[model samples]
Target: MPDPERDIASRYREHTGRKRTYILTGFVLLVVTAVLSIAVGSVDIPPQDVVRTLAGYSVSTNWDNIIWNVRLPQVLTAIVAGAGLAVTGMVMQSILRNPLGSPFTLGISNAAAFGAAFSVIILGAGSTSSRVGDAVTINNPYTTTIMAFLFAMLVTAVILAFSRFRGTSPEVMILVGVAMGSLFTAGTMFLQYFADDVQLAAMVFWTFGDTARASWEELGLISAVVAASVIYFTFNRWKYNAIDAGDETAKGLGVNVEKVRLVGMMFASIVTAIIVAFLGVIGFVGLICPHMARRIVGDDHRFLISGSIITGSLLLLSADTAARIMMQPYQLPVAVLTSFLGAPTFIYLILKGRRI
Candidate 1:
C-alpha cells in the first residue's frame, strides 16, 4: 500500500504545480481577452484590420482612428490599472497580515478623492464664452490627476508617521486607517455638497469611474508607471512574504521589515494614485484580489503576486467588456460592475476566512 503521508505530500506538490500551470493559462487568457476587447465593439473590426492598422496599412480613416486612438488607450488603461491594483493588494495584505488590508483600508482612496474634489470644486472657473475677445480657459486634467496621486501618498505618509512612534499592532493600524478614511470621506462629502452643478457632474462621473476619458496620452503615461512598479515588485516578491511572518523573524532572516514595509507602501501608494487618476476609484478590487490569489497559490508571493495580477486583470477586463456590451448605446461605469461582482466575493471571503 502507498504510504499515506507520502501520498498526501505528493498530492500537495501536484496541487501547487497545478496552480502554477493555471497561472500561465491565465496569462494566455488575459492576452486573448485583450485582443477580443479591441475587436468587439459597435464598429466591429476584424482581427486582420487590427493587425493591419498596427502595421500602418490603410483602413477606413475613421476606423483606424477609432482603433489606434480610442480602443488602444482604453485597453492599455484597463490592463495597467488591473495589474497595478492587484500587486498593491497583495503587498498590503502581506504587510498587514490581514486579508482585508488594502490601499482602501488605509483611506488612500478617500484622500485621493478629496484631492480630486478640491481640484474640481475649489478651482472651478467660469468658462468665458469667447465672443471674439475673451480668452479660453483650459483646465489641466493631468494636474488634477497628479493631485489625486499626491494626496494618496500624503495620507499614507500620515498613517506611517502615526504608526512609527507607536507600536504597530494590527488593531491599531486598522483603527487608524478607519478613522482617517472617515475623516477624508467626510471632507469629500462636504466639498461635494457645495460644488457647483457643473463641478458636481464631473465629480460624480469620476467617483463612479468609467474609461470614458482614457486617451492615448494618458495611456502612455499610466502604462510607463505601471510597468516600472511591476518590475520593482516583481523582483522583490520574496520580501513581501517575509513580512507575513512578522518583523522580527523577517529581520533575523535578513529581510529589512521596516524598509520592506516602507518601500512596499510607497510602491503601493504610487499604484493607487496612478490607477485612481487614470480610471477613477475602482473599489473592492484591491481588497479582494490578493486574498483570492493567496487562497489559490498558498501565500507564496512569488507565484501569488503574478497570479493575483493575471486574475485581477482578467476580472476587470471582462467586467469592462460586459459593461460596454450590456448597455448597448450607453456603457455602464466600469467601477459599478466591478463593485457589484467584487462585493459578493469579498463577503464570501469574509465568511470563508476560517477555511483559509
Candidate 2:
C-alpha cells in the first residue's frame, strides 16, 4: 500500500509550486509589458533609453520629457486601473455568487457616464465653443470627473440600501443593478438630447475610456485608492473564501455573511467608481480578468487575488500598447480592444462548459 503521509506531502508541494510559478510568470509579464508600453508610443523611444531615463540617467531632453511626462504616466494609469477593476470584479463575483457579476453589471459605469453627460449638457462643464474665427476654448475640465464620481457613489448607496433590507440575495442585487442601469442609461440619453454639438462630442469622448487623459496628479490619487482597496481585500481574503462557498455554509462557519457581502460590495463599488471616473467606462477587464485568474490560481483568494492583479495589469497594458500602435498616428480606444479580446474568451469559456 502507498504511504498516505508521503502522498499528502507530494500533492501539497505540487500545489504550492504551481501557485508560485503562476505569480512569478505574471510579475515578469507585467514588467515586460510596462516597459514596452513606455517605449512604443507615437514617438518611439528605444528600450535601452527608456530604462536609462527611468534610472535617472541623462538622455536627450525631448526623449526624457516624452517618457516622464507622457508615456510613463499613461502606462502606470493603465496598470493601476486594470488591477483595481480586476480585483473589484473578483470580489463582486465572489460576494454575489454570480458568474457574470462585475462593476459594469452593477451599473456603476452607466451611472458615471450619466453623471458625465449631465455635467457636459446641463452644468455646461467640459464644454467648448468656437466663434466663426475664434479658436475653441474648454471650460470646467474637472466638472465631468467630479460629477461622475458623485453619481457612481449615489448608485452604490442605493444598491447597498436595498441590500440592507433584501438580505444580500444575489438575485435581488443583480436585478437591482439591472433596474438602476436602465434608469441611468435613460438619464444619459435625456441629457444627450439637450446637448450642443461640442458638449455632445465631449460626452462621447469621455466615454471612450482613454488612459491618455490621466495626469500625474490623477495617477497619484488612483494609486493610493487602488493600494488601499487591495490591502483591504487581502485582509478579508479568508472571509471572501467563505462567502464564495455559499452564504449558508459561510454562516455555519461563523462568518457574518451579510456584513461581509455588504462591505465587499461597497469597497468594490468605490474602486470601480474611481477607475471609471478617471478613465471613463473601460469594461470587460473586470469580467474577464477574474475568470482568467481563477483558472490559473484556482479558488483560494490569497493566490487568486494576486494573480488577478498581475494578469489584469498585463492585459490592460498590452491592450493599451496595441491601441497606440494599431492606428499609427491615430489611436483607438483601449476599451474597444479589451471588449474585442474579452468577448471571445468569455464565449469560449461558456461553450466549454467551464465553471466561471
Instruction: Tell me the TM-score of model 2.
Output: 0.94
List TM-scores for all candidates, in order.
0.87, 0.94
- Model 2: per-residue lDDT, tens digit, 22-130? 8998898899779878989778888888899999996999998899998999899999999999999998889889878888888899999999998888888765565
- Each model's total of backbone clashes: 0, 0
Q: What is the lDDT of residue 320 in candidate 1?
A: 84
| C-alpha RMSD for every candidate | 4.5, 2.9
lDDT of 1 by residue, 168-220 (tens): 55565667778888998999899989977667766666667666567777777
- State the C-alpha lDDT per candidate: 0.76, 0.86
Instruction: Kindly give the stretch of ten consecutive residues in candidate 2 with the minimal lDDT sum.
Output: 129-138
In candidate 2, which residue pairs clash? none
